[model samples]
Target: MLLAKVIGSVVSTQKSPSLTGKKLLLIQWVNADGSLPAQDQIRTEIAVDSVGAGEGEIVLVTCGSSARRVFPEPNDAIDMAVVGIVDSVSQNLSA
Candidate 1:
């Protein structure tokens, strides 16, 4: 899983049957410290919203095969999915 911010939404008139009713969101990758990446290094992707995450909200993204498991149809053609909305994140700086 990775942390990201929902930047915008995607609307497609035609989509695969499995993705017909899913909400697609544009998300930008976020650093573990909660800072966004440099402008040049910014990476954005489209993810299926499984948790009803809204734009500007911090969300948890699951990628690869694991992303498909969240839907009722496990074979859904999804490479990424928003699994959770983040309220806060904590990490130990010292190792």
Candidate 2:
């Protein structure tokens, strides 16, 4: 899974049948400091919203085969999916 920020949404009028009612989101992976990368350096990606995460929210994105598992059918056309919404991120002091 990858930690990312939901920057925006993606609207698809035509899509595969398996994704009929799915929501797509534009996400940018967060830096080590839990901050967004610079606009010029952003590598944005689209992820299917599985957790109902909204824009400006920090979310967990699962990629590849793992991401497809969220759908009822294993063959769903999804390479990435927003699987979790982050409430907080904590670092261990001892680490």
The candidate maximizing TM-score is 1
Worst lDDT 10-window in candidate 1: 68-77
Model 1 Cα lDDT, one tens digit per residue, 1-95: 99999999899978788888889999999987778989998999999999989988999999998899888883468989999999998888895
Candidate 2, residues 36-66: lDDT per residue as tens digits?
Answer: 7788877899999988899999999999988
lDDT for predicted candidate 2 compared with the true structure = 0.87
Off by over 4 Å in 2: 38-41
The clash numbers for all candidates, in the given order, read: 0, 0
lDDT values for all models: 0.91, 0.87
Model 2 steric clash total: 0
Give the Cα-based TM-score of candidate 1 against the true structure: 0.91
